[model samples]
Target: MITSELLEKYTAVKKTFSKNETIFEEGNLPLYYYQIISGEIKMSNYNDDGREFIQGIFYKDQSFGEPPLFLNQKYPANAIAVEDSEIYMLPKANFMKLLEENPSISVKIIENLAQRLYYKSVMAAEMSTQEPEHRVLKLIDYGITHFDFKKDQNGYLINFTRQQIGDLTGLRVETVIRTIKALEKKGKLKIINRKVYR
Candidate 1:
């Protein structure tokens, strides 16, 4: 991610959204480079039956929906604020100019994109062949590494809710709950004070 100092130079506007607000919807044309300054955002899509599948969750200091910007295509999923949030929006032209002027930032962006691609590949394989428990654990582990989740004396605490876990793992919420309890019993994770840690 680019530092705030560098981002400030190119930021076109600062925008705020309320919880559950859609920042952008699927099939929208890419226009801005969005970087979160506070709160959480999820890139997701809903099935025909209205079940949500989260492509990714992003927090403060992270950027989302960049692939479409670079590819000159429409957004593949919706970005919604999970809570009231502030974000920096850089015009697409300005974002490209910034990347051209800053090679290091461009390299960092490429690395971040590659990491996302790797995560998607791994999750795709897991969803197709892995059991619920395995899929859940893989999702948590990926979040810990990719999202910079922190550890305490107990373990690395995962911040996602059960519903979010289900969405990310392509499982039903009931299944996610059962799988998590099973994981706890198997010593794979701990649910301390109702929060999952691993």
Candidate 2:
């Protein structure tokens, strides 16, 4: 992630959005680099039948939709605010200039992109060949590692909702519910006060 100081030096503009608001639509030209300052955002796409497939969820200090910026292509998915959120947006030209002028920041960006690519590859394999339970567990494990989850005496709490889990794992919400219950029964995770902890 780029530091606040670097972002400020580049004159990133802070913008806010309400819950369910579209930040950018799929197929739109990538014109800016966006970094979350507060709340949650989801990058997703809808099928012909209007079924939603979540690409990823991002939290504060995280950037989204950067691949297209670097590749000079249209955005592959829509970005929406999941809650009232604030974000910093830098114009594409300025962002490119920033990277050009800051070698260390450019290296960090490359590392971030590589991590995302790795996650996508792993998830692709899980989706194609894994059972529902296995896919769900793998997603939870990935979230814990990628999101830097904090552990308590019980376990690491996952911050995603059941619906979000279903979307991310390509399962229905009912299936997610059933699989999570089964995982709990098998002592794989804990369901405390209707929230999941792994």
Candidate 3:
């Protein structure tokens, strides 16, 4: 998890993502590691046909684009904030220096990437074997374990659209809708207008 002291060292930038704004696009040169202070960022990509697809969703207190910064590599996917948000950015030079200066920080970064990879592997397996609804539940469970969702009463408050969730889970939007509707019908989840709860 990220700490306030870590944030104190970085410059906080007040930026807004008007509904759907691209923070960083895929194939761009890796620059800074951004920490979300508020709001959510939807990491996604587009196919060769120019079809947009969501890859993952990140919320507050989480960091993104750090893994590929090991040696200033290009981003593998696009990152866009779901709503207006603020981010604390540590430029590559400062970020790498900070880690090199602190062994503990480097260890934390390694552990964070390892954990993310582990969950991604699990999601991959689930995508091959589970249904769309089950995949969504698994994503929720994965988020809960990684982000401490249960610690807050509001849960994760993921602001992604159904289509975005489908992209993340490798399911179609219609499948996501049907699965969510099924979950709501079973009283396993709450779908109030556009928001989702479990």
Candidate 4:
């Protein structure tokens, strides 16, 4: 991600978004390069039945919705704030210029995008072929590596809620709950005071 000082130099504006606010809607033009300052954001799409599938979750210092920006295409999913968040939004033109002037930052951006692609590819295969336990554990492990979930004496604390897990894994919330319980019984996971640890 671009550093805060660099972003500011490129005219990136830090703006606040309330929980549940849409940063950009599905099919909208990609006008800005968005990087979170604090809080969470989700890119998601809903089915006709109103069931949502979360494309990805992003946290502080992470950039989201860049593939479309690089391609000059419309957003494929809606970007919504999971909580009241402050984010740096640089106009697409300036963002491109900043990248051109900073090769190291550009390399970081490429690596970040590659990691996301790898996660999606792995998740796609798991959703199509793996069992629920496998899917959940894979996600947790990826979170530890890519999302930087913290480790403690117990284990790595899982930051995702059951609903978020369900959406990410293409499972029902009931299924996620049942799967977690089954995992606990099998020594694959632990739920401590209602928070999941892996």
- Which candidate tops TM-score? 4
Q: Could you give the candidate ranking by lDDT, starting with the highest?
A: 4, 2, 1, 3
Candidate 4 lDDT over 1-198, as tens digits, reads: 678999999999999999999999999999999999999999999999999999999999999999999999999999999999999999999999998999999999999999899899999999999999899999888888888888898899999999999999999999999999999999989899999998
**Candidate 2 regions off by >4 Å?**
none
Model 2 per-residue lDDT tens digits across residues 1-198: 788788978999999999999999999999999999899999999999999999999998999999999899999999999999999999999999999999998898999889999999999899889999999999999999998777998899999899999999899999999999999999999999998999
TM-score on alpha carbons, each prediction: 0.97, 0.97, 0.83, 0.98
lDDT of 1 by residue, 3-116 (tens): 777778886578999999999999999999999999999999999999999999999989999999999999989999999999999899999999999998899999989989
> In what order do the candidates fall by TM-score, top score first?
4, 2, 1, 3
Which wins on lDDT, candidate 3 or candidate 4?
A: 4
- In candidate 1, position 176 carries an lDDT of 95
Quantify all predictions' global Cα lDDT against the true fold: 0.94, 0.94, 0.76, 0.95
Segments in model 4 whose C-alpha atoms lie over 4 Å from true places: none
Query: Could you tell which candidate, 1 or 3, scores higher by TM-score?
Result: 1
lDDT, candidate 3, 82-189, per-residue tens: 888777777788777777777797898789788878888998899999978799888866765666454336345544468777887888889888988898899777
Better lDDT candidate (1, 3): 1
The pairs that clash in candidate 3 are none
Error of 1 at 111 (Å): 0.4
